[model samples]
Target: MGFLQPNLPQLDLESWRRGTRNERMRPLVAHLCEVGFGTPDVVYLFYVVKIGLYLLGAMAFAVATAGVDGLFSVGDWWSEPIVFQKLVLWTMLFEVLGLGCGFGPLNLRFLPPLGSFLYWLRPGTIRLPPSPALVPGTGGRMQGTVRGPVDVVLYAALLGTLLVALLADGTRSSGDLPGAAGLLPVWLVALPLVLLGVIGLRDKTVFLAARSEVYAAIAVTFLFSGVDMVVGAKLVMLVIWWGAAVSKLNGHFPFVVQAMMSNSPVWRWRRLKHRFHRSFPDDLRPSGLSRALAHGGTAVELSVPLVLVVSSGGWVTAVAATVMIAFHLNIISSIPMGVPLEWNVFMILAILVLFVDKAAYGVGDLSGEGVLVLAVPIGSAVLVVLGNLYPERISFLPGMRYYAGNWDTTVWCFTPSGLDKFDAGTVKAAMLPHQQLERIYGEAEAEVPLFTGYAFRAMHTHGRAHFALVPRACGESHDDDYLVLDGELVAGVVLGWNFGDGHLHDERLVAALQERCGFEPGELRVIVLDAQPIHRPTQSYRLVDAATGELERGTVLVADMVVRQPWDTDLPITVTPAPQVEC
Candidate 1:
């Protein structure tokens, strides 16, 4: 790939024009392993610039806090507990503003580059309530989906609350350590935490936008004073590390490494990139090298955090922190699809501050109410437990399943009928995904960029399974009848942004769209694939149409998908037909 241009595969342009969708995949998916989605070098630079803006914005927020004043002199006050607390709030605010994880061309946001604040602040947009029966003031007149005035208030209030907290001064000078800076009052930090919880119950889209799993945990720590707060934060990070490591125990994570490296701007060597695949153009299944790296990294994530916490201020702690720092830096350099750049940088800071600087303050230092602070990590662990067991109900983020190649995924299959309805019926902030891609790459050559998005997905283990089942979801003549897309893309078009949580675009979401678009039976079809449960070998799936309800329900063996190529659309399935609808 050139610094200014995309190095696309050598293909017969006329042959591609004549080939069917399945036929096109043969070359496209292969090219994905070697050349990636053929994204231009300039686009990666665009993300690098965005990362700077996000960091500068965060530091500005922290600097506004009365006690903190380290712009050019970060080394002077970087270790202050107050600085740590303020940055946590700023990160939550950053993500909530749609500038964090799912922002820019990396996550497929091309036109305006983000949809969070735009979609949430507006009235009459779509909103998905977690449960209308349990939560009053939810489920609008339009089949429990429309965003009424109440929805707008809840979202805006959360943003306003976060801003108020970010700009507020510290409550008092810290007693935890001599000369430590003042910390944000417990109430100020708690206020946004409460609002985020309320907003989450109202709309998971806004909730996930904040990247609450990681940020909320840090926010919880701010409520505690002194040593207890930092130790509690360390434990919370531990759970996150453990959960991510355990999730990688499956046959999926290698796919993540290969795909991540394939698209990475830092990894310009194509031969080294091909090394992750079995034989590159022929057998694109993960090579031994990919698995070794995936599992080896998993071992590091699991063991290092424990050592970082258990080892009191010493070389052991420093070594553990160094290992973890290198781990996060490696990931950040890859500039993975989700573009969780800020989070990685924060983790590096966390290792330095919480684990290394405060290494002497262990959980043993907890006194009185500080012991109760243990509940934060305990609660996070329980969520991870439930997430792994019941992935369909819980998002991978909350389950602590960060980038382990396991995800609840969906494939949106649409004909012109459904597309027309979706285009006309929904109230959205951004243009349709294909439209945005075309606007960026031109209508004639948009497929190169569009399929690049799919390449990223198929690099994951579940994505291969999702594509294999697309035929069954769209029907036998799916290739000719429907244009298949990752549910995340469609979610971005309709919901404004998607951070890889399929629940945002699952059957429940389809029900919401069905209420508005009123699709005919053949118009819209969705294939919802749940993340593989930790205890189960197979992942369950559902096929649904917008007009009708479920069309089929079944399971696809993980064994079948792990071995197939990215474009292999035929994996044998264990299945049961849905109750047929009458004309």
Candidate 2:
């Protein structure tokens, strides 16, 4: 009956679903479309194009330098002139002229107009020209303007001409005859162009134009010099290689060849074994049997080039090779990471070869012999080491101390062993005995006053008590334990007793008071609280009176009172209650 009683009408489910059909379907479709593919690959492709261009430029230069005729030359190619070489020679000449005259004045004439065009084209890349300002004058103000296109072009032209001139000169002097002839005309044209460029660099508007030109010339000259040095060094190396080969076939003793061969690994190892065995450490066996396999490999690598240098009979080539080897060795030694000790050994070996060649053969004149002579100190050092290991019974005069007078005169004094004669009487007086009278009196006294105090009123009302009288109990307490007198803190005066061998003094407490409490030594107030019994078996305290408002030794006690101990245990007596008692 209950289940049937609450029956209600059911609504249609299809009506509610139909009302929101578009809204539910829209978001589901949007999320499915949003998930995209991989990232863009344009950046990697751009870098590849840039690198290819740079490589292409370098290849072009190399091909231009090495003539096409040389590249294609066969066995009997001595007679023909190279067309490509001639073309390159002419091209360089035109480049020199263009730099000196065309670019030089042209740069000045078009710089402003060109810059304005470029700024418009690439608005974000270029900066606008600055506005001119007026300078105050007695008569009127004068306006200053920036350097225009003409001035800038003239400066660039001068720099270009200088570079061309330097390159031409280097090629003529250092290159082969054909190459020299090719570059000579360009060099000649550059000289006149340089002069013309300088003349064209006129800046009538600027007051400091002359100074600017001078600085520019100096800077360009230095830049040219650096370029020349690099080119010259390369040329020299090439020439030396050619000369060494020629000298070897001629059957002459090439000193350069010998030096190079000596620097080579194989020759160095062979000689190091034969001649430098005793000089190097014994662990590095010269006999080859005890040596590592790597040493033999290094020897083989060095030997081949060295043999060529020696056979070549070019002494200069040999020396250059040796220098190269030394440089390489130095580089190895200077590496920031890995195998530093091994590299150091290599450097030392190279140096040893140089020294031996200079010493034994005197190959480069008597200069080598002079170096060997100066190396006597090295031998002496070895001898000093040997001397230390072995003992010798030897004696020398004892060192003496002398006193000098005002006029640079020396006065001799007796040695330390003769001190007995100098102060014999003072020594005897110190040794003279005295009876223990104080101890005897202390024991004989019917009553020993254990408590003694000494105090001093401040010298100047605000100033310190000039002196302090210390009590024996003061040293036993901590630094914070102190006796205050007349409302002023006083802890500077204390017993000089040192626990654990008299090392701990009251100086630390005094210093603490001066620094932390802002009390100078002259501002100190002291009260000596002596804990001794007063006319009884019980412990008592006393406060001593000051003499001339200063607390010092022998100041008499002013007040005495016996106080019962709170506890019978061996605890330190309280000096706190002692200060409270009126004197």
Candidate 3:
């Protein structure tokens, strides 16, 4: 019976194969499956759109550069070939477009509306639920599995193109435009295409690597290009000025001649100073042993740009090159492990300036010599008067109070000492009033005369409290004094205290609160404490609250008050009301 059943299925299969529908649709089904598995039509569409946008951005850059004569000067002579210049221009355009796409919203319009609409139409896509397959881990695994075939095809294409380009003869051009090499352009285009192919195939890994490489390339190119542009611009300006002078001399105008001669010496002096300053400054400070050692670790830091500049042309070219170098150094310094070269260059220019005038105007000329001699003394006298009028050595301590302003509303009381002292148990019984007095007041009262003299001056000038303790004064005493001042019990003390100075004792703090604010011992209430620091010369508090302290619990009785170091002063503080107890 089982054999008969199998034979019956075989007969049915034979009948189905012979039917008209199977015969008509087999090839079409196969073709559809092949296209679905092998081609990525969407990716190609994106690439075309991106290229168009890049071309548009490049055109914009070129137009902008044309208006700024200082940016795109070709100079009287061109060192680089026309082809090389074109390549640079294209590369710059690509960079600009890439940068715009990354930072700006210009590329968002390229996404296919049809695909987005289709995605929204699907219930699963529009309202995704938490499914195991949709989780990150599953998606990552799927991506990993799918990427292998794409990577193989991409790498194979890249390798084949590279090998063909390398092996092809440059002299014997195979394509049209005979005898002229067509391969160079092909190679140039292929290089970036291969890079993009590899980057696209690798997915996330390629994204990070490509992003870093693109940024670095853009930065390096900008530095070199800027230097080239500056030098070229300066040369063009010099030529223009020289031409104008020659035209005036050739003309038959008496006024032009007189004007040219009258300004001749001044122009000459300016040119001399500009050249000297551009090369080396008047205050060129060289690196000492320590500085040299530090800088020497990065040998290429300064040498690479110097080499590029020297190779391009000598000191004249170096001026623009050095400026670019300084710019790059400034950028790197903004990161880490780098120092800005601008200050160093400025110092060099200063040193150069002192002697530049003397060299340009010889000692034999009375007018030139007199001006040069008087420059230093005249500059010194002016600086001296300014320095005396506005002394830089004003005391920070004396200005604290003026800077802090009103203290009572801004101050916070947190310690038990700032509360009622008479109700506590065993310790209160043993110590009595004398012990309580010693614990609360400490030696600070005795030393207040000495410390207050300085503190009062600081408070009066700064309008803020100095929380620092007097030397030889007890810790509790310092806290008491600071609290008293902060609570407005003391007439002249600034309200704020530096957490570093041990001014957070509970007993002293509570005593000040009780003495000044009229809060009874063991009374619990929510209190908000401000933690702003007072700035000198501006009597304002940049307030912040306590973060993680007894006050952070939201609600708790004043069970214990302990003073700890203040690290982050701007955190929020929340205090809970305490239960009242009979004394």
Candidate 4:
């Protein structure tokens, strides 16, 4: 790949457009398998620099908070309880501000290159309520108005409250532990939580964008005192790692590893990328190497934290900490597409702060809270179970299944006019998917990046399944009448930011779009695929028309997806067409 330019596929536009779906996807798939995203070295370097800046900014926050003296002096202050708490707050601020996860070209974001705070802080921006029917005082003008002054103020207040809390000096503790000198005031921590939760009720966008599910839970632990605070933080990390690991015990995970490793810039050789797949075209399941990496990584995630939490300042603690740090570093070095660089960095810092440095704060160190100690992990475990069983009900973030390949995914097939209607209809921060491509590559050349996106989606197992099922989902609609885009791209346009979750664009989002755009039955067709359950080989899928409603619901076996090449769209689907429901 060129330093400034992406390697583009050499294809005759007229012939490519007229070709069969698989015919069009074939060249792109070969290109991707060999070149990955074909992302330029310059772009990768840019993200690396951004990662450096993020770490420096966190260190600066730590120093400014009087938690550390110098950047290199982490050895001296790394264990400070308040420092860790402020780091969590600081990371949350960074993410909510649109600079953390799902930022820039890697996530197919351009123009503004981000959408979280940009969308949330603006009045008249769209906000998706999780459940408008169930929540009282949630309907009427408050439901989906142009974000009024109050919404903007509330979002700004959440940001401001978080900043103030990060800057606030924690009260000195009457403890003997070396790092347990100060604690964030309960009210200071609680204020942002309440504000975030309240704003989230109105805008699930802000909630998911802030990653309130992960960071907010950690922030709540800051409200506790003494050993409870330490134990609470430890439990939260355990949930994150354990939950993610547990979620990986499935048929879909190997596919994720194969795709992720193929996309890894660190693994530059095409041969290495090819090895992850079973073969070129016929047998495209994840290779043995991919499965080993997937399962081994899962084991590390599941086992290391347990060893870290239990080992009380011995060589065992040292080895576990090293493994955990290396684990996160490996992920960071891979430079995954979502560019969750800062999140991985934060996890590394967390290992040092909570596990290695605060090693003594185990279950035996628990203070007044006995039963409550088990509640957080147990509750998180239950969510993981429910999340896996019925993924439609929970966001993947809360489900804690980070990068385990399996995720709720959707594909929206839109007519050209339908795309225009969406642009005219929705109150959004970013341009439509095609529009963003146009801005970056120019109107004349936009289709290049546009189809490159399709290829990227096809690299994943769900992409193959979703697109393969689209014809059946949309009925016998003419191919030229619509364009296919990942639901994350649609979510980016509608919800501000999407970190690879289809829940953002499921039936709920369909209704929201229909309410605004009034799309005709053929204008917009969506397929929502749920993450696969651990014990089951099949994953559930739902099809809905933007104008009409549910059209089909079904299951696609994992075996069908992994066996096909990236360009292949002939996956066997088991459909249960639903009676047409009105919007």
Rank ordering of all candidates by TM-score, starting from the highest: 1, 4, 3, 2
Error of 2 at 378 (Å): 34
Ranking 1 against 3 by TM-score, winner = 1
lDDT of 1 at 537: 90
State the C-alpha lDDT per candidate.
Answer: 0.82, 0.23, 0.25, 0.80
| Per-residue lDDT over 176-243 for candidate 1, one digit per residue giving the tens place of the 0 to 100 score | 75335588788888888988898887887888888898899878977887778888999999998998
TM-scores, all models, native as reference: 0.96, 0.18, 0.19, 0.94
Cα lDDT of model 2 by residue, 18-89, tens digit: 432222222221211121001112322322343344333323432343232233342222211222122222
Clash counts for all predictions: 0, 18, 39, 1
Residue 197 CA displacement from its true place in model 4, Å: 1.7
Query: 1 or 2: which has the higher TM-score?
Result: 1
Shift in Å, residue 189, candidate 1: 1.0
Off by over 4 Å in 4: 12-14, 66-68, 141-146, 370-373, 475-477, 577-583
Write the residue-wise lDDT of candidate 3 on 1-583 in tens digits. 1211110111233443343321212222222111211113343333436545544433333323212222234332112211122223343223322222221111111122112112212222111111224433313432222324444344345334433333333322222111222223334334645454443434322222122222212212212222232232222222222222222221111211111221222222333322211111221111132123223322333333333323334454455445544544433222110111222232222212211211222223223223333332233333323322221211111111111111212233333543333233111101222222345346433222222222221212111122221111113433333222232211011111111111222222333223334444323221222212221121212121122123222311111111111111122223334567989
Task: Give the TM-score comparing model 3 with the true structure, all chains together.
Answer: 0.19
